[model samples]
Structure formats: structure tokens, C-alpha cells
Target chain A: MDDLWYSEYHTPHVRFSVKVSRQLHYEESKYQKISVFESPEFGRFLTLDGIMMLTERDEFIYHEVITHTAMAVNPEIKNILVIGAGDGGVVRELGKYQGIESIDVVEIDERVVEVCKEFLPQTSCGFEDERVHLHYQDGLKFVRHTDNLYDLIIVDSTDPFGPGEVLFTKEFYGNCYRALTEQGVLINQHESPFYEEDAKAMKSAHRRISHAFPMSFVYQAHIPTYPSGHWLFGFASKSLHPQRDLKADAWNALEIKTKYYNTELHQGAFGLPNYVKEMLKDE
Target chain B: MDDLWYSEYHTPHVRFSVKVSRQLHYEESKYQKISVFESPEFGRFLTLDGIMMLTERDEFIYHEVITHTAMAVNPEIKNILVIGAGDGGVVRELGKYQGIESIDVVEIDERVVEVCKEFLPQTSCGFEDERVHLHYQDGLKFVRHTDNLYDLIIVDSTDPFGPGEVLFTKEFYGNCYRALTEQGVLINQHESPFYEEDAKAMKSAHRRISHAFPMSFVYQAHIPTYPSGHWLFGFASKSLHPQRDLKADAWNALEIKTKYYNTELHQGAFGLPNYVKEMLKDE
Candidate 1:
């Protein structure tokens, strides 16, 4: 990897990118980079974008917040399918539940998974977990084939304009609806609400998801290294509203060492501002 | 004023400025840079180390969470003084209560006030209000002149290295105690908790404030544009423990347009990660 640039977003977290690995196995894309570093406290890091998407210590926050929030609301969540989680962070988090029978991860880039297994072992822990299974295939193709099976589906994809763009479209959302059971829940990593276009894209995605699912909503979290230091996640469920009134003690019993996503934060995360609420309504 | 850099914390709300004014009207400082820009939707933007710190659109989340949490616990609150609040966002928020009698804003840079008034009028509204009296002077000197007077004194200074360094010292905390009435509350804007040195400085300041006052504590807020998205504020009071069982109606009645600060958020902001809470206990 070569030709890298680092921009100081906020203090410790610097967003940087290097060239695609010379041994890169994936098809060429407009912009793709391979970079790795280690933080003093967060351990090893690997990001698809120049942006530091997650620290090794805090990756659970994004994965758990998306997975568990839906799982808690949809108590019958047994079969889970994760889309584009090449890092395996989502699958790792999903494997925590005792009730979850099987978890399948569909990733387009086998190289990302291979790299994670070799370098980012912490994130790749899901691959080794007995309950988890990996499928090196396009998420869209996998979701289209499945029918009324998965109780929870998580789309942990990259930015919308990249290979992940198809996942944000109406067609993919329709397939997700078809792939889910009546009580199933789907969560996606939406773009930031700070920029107009990102917000618009998220709102559009939310509208499409709402059309397919009974309930859909957006929530926010502070990812310091991300653009504008804030990011939003979109959630859609067939029957559940995604708001769980349970205490942290109920979930803290699992004893996950998460830097951010606590039970108290789970509820508080959904408390949107009037502006965000208005935007959702406008959608 | 010449060679100025104005940082808009919120897109259209608050902006903090560092201006090298030709004439030194109030005091003989090398340059005059004011702290706290409390414009309309832009809550409070503080300038430190020639850099501007802006929170999300929700300024009250940081300001109210810092000020009110301490103030609410201290039942006997009357006179208050805010240091370096050129934007008057804190003062405006403080003005909401009938318990607060007179509020004195001690700002060193009149140019900042003028700029805020001209550019960000909503923050300047604090000055126009009858309860707030403007004192264009040094905060350190002003604190030195009094003993057990103010019920609450908010050190809304910039970063610790610049004009704000004095505000973060033991002497300044001692002066604050001297200026405060018995059972008085004091809250100061500390720097990013992510930076060890800044956290150490804040912890030291907390220790000093604890020595001067009976109780001292630190809390965090998510300010997107700050060095770290997560920033900490130190709170100290002679008698109060800084916890309030807030009624829903009371919390809801605060007529501030906030994107983040709510009653639940007010409590949640104090809930720190174990690492941050552990850092506060260091020697």
C-alpha cells in the first residue's frame, strides 16, 4: 500500500488512507485503500476508507448497538444474517446471544475477510465462532435467495456510493423484507446527518425501508473519527418498534466490555432532535 | 480588529473569534480573543489556543449539563458571575430561573462581544436582558476582589494554555471560592478528556476546586468540532453533591432549541465510561 494522506479530524483520531494493496484480490473500484495501524489502548486497526471507522476497543459499540437493539426488541431472533461485515465485528457481536442458533455473514470482498483473519484477528473472531458461518458472495444476491427465514438482518456496509450503494436502494430493501420473518428486524449503517447529501441519502433509504417494514427509525452516535464526529444508524422491523425499556443490568449480565453501547445509551440513542424527527417525517 | 479567525461552532448558531485588536481598551494583553459564542441555533463556541470549539447545534446540552447539574443541587442560588462568556449563552440559560438574582459576565475582550452582537445577536441577547450586568474586565482580578459573594461562578474560559490557563489553576479556583457564597456552585469548561495532558489538567483543576470546595466532579459532553468529539467539564461546589431528581415538566419547560440536551440526556452525559471515570481519580 502507498500514497496515503492523513487529515486530523479531532485530536488523537486521524483519518488516513493508503493505496490498495499490490496483492489486492478484489476487482478495481474508484477508491479503495488498505491501511493498518495500532492504537495505544484500542489495539490493531484496519479501515476500508482512509477514515478510522472504528477502534478495536470500540468496534463492539457499532456492532452491538445495531444487532442487540433489534435482537432485544425482536425476542424471537434466532437466525441472523449479516451483510457486508467483512471485518466480522457484527457476527462476533451477534454470536453473544445464547438463543441465536446460527449466524451467516455475506461479504463481497473475500480479501477483506482474509486480511481481517490474518491481521485484525480480534474483529475476525466471528469466523472462528462455532455458531457463525461465512459466505463469500454479494449481499444482494444472498438476500434475494433467502425467504422468510432470518429473524434479524444487519447491513454493516460501507458508504452508500461505494459497493454498498445497492444495499441502500429500494430493491435491496424489498429483498430484505422478503428475507425476514414476520418478527424480523433489519438495521443498516446510515450515513451522517451532518452533510445534506448524506442526510438525504439516509432519509431516502429510511423511506424505502419504511415502505417495506412496519416500523423504521434513525438514531445517532458519536464516532469521533468520522466526518462531523457524528453518525446515524437506520433501523427497520416488521413488528417491533426497536425501543426496549429494559435496564442495563438486564443486558450487562452478558458482560460485554463495550466502550459505548450500554443499555442506558440504547434508549437515549433514539431520543432524536426535532430537526431529525422533522426530517424523518419529511421522508 | 485585524487578523481575526472566526470559527462557527454550529453552522448558523455560535462562532468564537480570536482577534488582534489595535487598541487595548480593558487590559494590556498581547491579543484579545473572546470565548463563548452563543448565537441563535449555534449555542456556545469557545476559542482556545487560537482554535474554535463548536458543539453540535445543541449548545445547551454542554452548557446546561455543566451549569445546571451543579446549580440544581445547590438550592441556595442567588448571585452568579460568568467569566469569558462573550456570547452570553450560559448567561441566557441562567436567566431562565427566578432564583438567580443578578448575573455578572466578566469578559476581557469587548471586541468579541461587539462581534457576537453584530454577527450572532441571539447570544448578545443575554446582555440586553435586565438580570445580566456586563463587566468588561479580567476574570482573575474580578474574582480576587470578592469573598463568599456569588452563589455560582462559571469559569467559561477557553483552553488551559491560552487566556484560559489562569481559569484552570489552583489560584483561580481559590479565587472562585473566595468569590462564591457558602454552598456556592462552580463549573468550568475543561478540555478534551481524550488528551491525557488535558485530562490531567482538568483532574488537577478538579482537585484544586475540591480543596477549595467540599465536592468536585467531572462530566462529559459530545462536542463534534472539539479536539475530541467527547469533551469534559469540571464541576465543584461547597455543599451540593450535584444530583437532582428532575421532574419531567420542569425539564421540558426550558425554552431552548436544542438538538441534544434533554432531561434524559442531562443524566446520561454524566454517565462516563470506566476509563474516563478512572482517569479522574489519578493523582
Candidate 2:
């Protein structure tokens, strides 16, 4: 139609707008509203509840950082359970490692997968692999019910609002802890630290995850589509510390090519600013 | 005034906007259009030619990354030459170390310094320091004419466009190399790599700096007020390698309290992503 612009409220006083050439697709999914847009700069991008989920130009940074940080920490990790990664970006990155035997993706809404597979094949292409098992259900329930323990569990959920609210709670994190193997690692989409609401959510999630796992730390990546362009990921493990247990040589031996994640960056990402360090403190 | 929103074009198709409380000040300097705004989210911010220079909330990330990276690399740095840092953020950060004997700040436009002092004292406080010497003249000319040698040279100029364009050329970089002491370190504001225009500038600056100095590298910081929040800084020196010469223990001994720059991050910031590494490669 006309030159349409979509704006998202990064905070009450800040807004990020992208000029859309056209709306590629739009659907009211069971859990949230999913929309795909075509833009000249960012290429094609998907959004949930009017918030940017991933852009073709920058999704590699997010997915690679989230999936490979834990994988590099524990290269022997075979079984992976991804919750709320309906966009399939997380699973796509995990599929690169031949060592990963099984990948179980639990998405609350099936519509997201359907739309992504139709409109965003670059990310959804991983679903075609035989090792991936898609479970259409609530991730909170799936974690509680699954008797099979996982070597790694990735909470790739959306912002801590609407459909993704429960995933950031203490009960959900507790279930994730119980669902992990002896040396299991849990990585979650920790919120941004720039805005008030996001900082509050980031602190809450860190407190709960830190309580559940003996070791929990936060790392960051530059995701331009996100609120502050700075997005954080939580790394929690039973006995393996992200930095101390880091198998750098082992991960590098895999030769899995990545756009953003590297062994040095893996350790460096945990070197956060002093203010963010104060925000995630145990108090 | 009424409710007003400030918008900056990230790229041709992407826009970043903030709701402005009001325009603190605006002037058409001989070089460019300089404006200041008070925002609820980012606090007071300055703009040159409708592009964000820095914000009160996030200027620490930019200033810290640029100044402390070299300081940590060579803790004995006694004299510094700063070009085009009219806002005074870089000088303020450099003022922290007692070892820093003299700081010469060169600015093409005195209006930027005047406005920031009047409206943004948090960053402009460094101007009051007795050790800081301000020169209201072109940075390119300042570097070429100065017979004085400095241990550190900081090129905190705006994007490589319009008035700030000449500072990114090879001739200017050669002058920076000549104007430095034997163990001198030079840091320049290399633009982001996400947008096409910015990526071009980043590559151009890197190539020139690499040509001038024997050891040249690029580092990044997350500045949300900028185009993509992913900003790069160029580090070049004659004999000092940023990582190899990094005196983490020495820098930490100074005990300078900062919100963003720390020794660990100083090392981590140099860990460039693979994509960025590819971009900076000598083709």
C-alpha cells in the first residue's frame, strides 16, 4: 500500500521505527500476535506482539551467542531442549554441531512455527532435520512433566510480558533445574538493562535462576533490533562454570562456522559493565 | 513547546526516535547543525547534523571504551591529545588518572563545547580541570602542525561525514602517527558495521590506520543512541599491541571508579565478531 512505518516502544519515552515496504504476513497466533515485514535495510524480520523478534540482517548474532555459549562450555552436550524458540533460530544454530544427538523444541503456540516455516525459511530450515522433535505445548508444563533429563536447556522465550511471563518465574526456573542432567546447563533470554521494566525483569530472572542453579552469570550481545541494542543471556549450570568450565579448544575443534560467537568472545561476553554487575547482584 | 519527538535516520529505511521533553538548545555552528535535547529515557543528549553524538545515560559506554582501552594497554601514558571530543566525555574520563599530566583537546566548533557546558555538565566537567587545554581549531590542522609528541591520541570525532570526514583519511592518520611518541597509542571512532554507509567508513578508517601503524586493530562498544547501537573504535600503535601490552594489574592499581570500563572488558572489547573481522580484513 503506502509507505507504512511500524514503531515499537522501547520504553515509555523511546521508540524504534522501521519503514516497511510491505507486511509479508500477519496472524493472531494462539499465544501472541506474529507479523513478518519486508524492509530495505533489515531485510525480512519477524515480530511478536509488535516487538521485534529477529531480523534477517542480525538474527545470527542472537542465535549464535545464545546456543553456542553453552555448547562451547560443554561440547559433549548431546541432548538439547529449547523452550519458546518457535522462530527456530536457536534450533537452527544447534543443528550445526554433529555431536548434538537430539533437539526437542517446546513452543506454546504451533502457529508461530507454521508462519515462520512459511515466511521465514532461513531460520525454520532446521525443523526439517530428523533429530529435531517439535512439541506443541506450554514450556512450563513440558519442563515439569518431562522425565527425560537434558544436557542443555535453552529458554529462548520472548520479552517477560504476555505469553512469556510464566517462563521467567521462579517455579519455571526450578522445573528447568530439575529437568537437567547432573552436569546440565540452563541458558535463558535475560532481559535488557536500559529501561525500568526491562531492568526489573532482568533482575528478577537473575535472582530466580541464581537460586535454582548454584552458578549463574549474565552475558551480553549487540542485537540492533532489541530495545537497547544490548541483549543479555543467562548462563546457569550445576557444576560447570561458563568461564572456568569453558572448553575453548574442544569447541574450536568442531569447526562450526559462526558470525558472532567465538571462544574469546564467549569469555569476554561475561565481562559486563559495572552498573549491570551491580544490578545482577545477589542482594 | 508541545509534545515533540526527535528522530534520526539509522539508515535509509530505519529510524530511531525519542520523545523529547523540549529542545535544550540548538545552533548552526560553522561546521554543522548542533542540537541538544532532554529526554526522559536517555536524559540530555547532543546531536550533530541530526545524528546522535552522546546521551547522558549511555555516554559512559562510549567514553569508557575509547579512553580506558588505551590507558589499560599502557598505564604509564602521561600525555594525551584528543581531537574533536567537543562534548568533553573523553577528556573527563582521561582526567581520572593522576598519572595523566597534560590533556590537549582540539575542537573545530567551540559552540558544541559551550552548549554541552551549559546543558550537560556531567560530561563537560572535565573542561574545568587545570590539566586540560582546549584548542578551538580544526583537529586535522592541530595534528599536522603540533611539534609536541603525545603518549596517547584520541580521535573522538563524529561519523566520517561532512565536517568530520577529513579526520578519517590516510593523511590525517599519518599525522597522528608522527605526532605520537615512540610508544604512543592512537584510538579513533570507527563507525558501526551494520549499515552500509557506516560499514564503508569503518573499513576506510581501519585501512588507513593499519597503513600508518604497525599494530592496528578494531574494538566495539554498545552505544544505543547511535545508529545500530554497535559502534567500533580503532586502536593502533607503533610497538604496543593492545592485548599483549595490556597491563590489567597496573590499570586496576589506579583504583579509578567507573561505570563501564574495567580491565576485563578492556580485553574483551577487542574480541571482534567474525563478520566484523572479515570486514576489516585487507582485501
Off by over 4 Å in 1: A1-4, A8-52, A55-60, A68-77, A181-183, A239-243, B1-48, B53-78, B95-100, B109-111, B114-122, B147-151, B170-184, B205-219, B235-244, B281-283
| Pairs of colliding residues, candidate 2 | none
Candidate 2 lDDT, B1-283, residue by residue in tens: 4679999888878888899999988889888998999988889999999989999989999999999999998989999999999998999899989989999999999999999999999999989889999999988999999999999999999888898998998899999999999999999989998889999888988888889999998888888888888889999999999888899998899998888888887778888888888898852
Question: Candidate 1 — which pairs collide?
Answer: B13-B42, B14-B42
Q: Pick the candidate with the highest TM-score.
A: 2
**Which stretch of 10 consecutive residues in model 1 chain A shows the poorest summed lDDT?**
A10-19
Q: How far out, in Å, is residue B186 in model 1?
A: 3.1
User: After superposition, which runs of candidate 2 have C-alpha atoms over 4 Å from their true positions?
Assistant: none
Grade the docking of candidate 2: high
Model 2 chain A: lowest-lDDT 10 consecutive positions: A274-283
Q: How accurate locally, in lDDT, is each candidate?
A: 0.66, 0.90
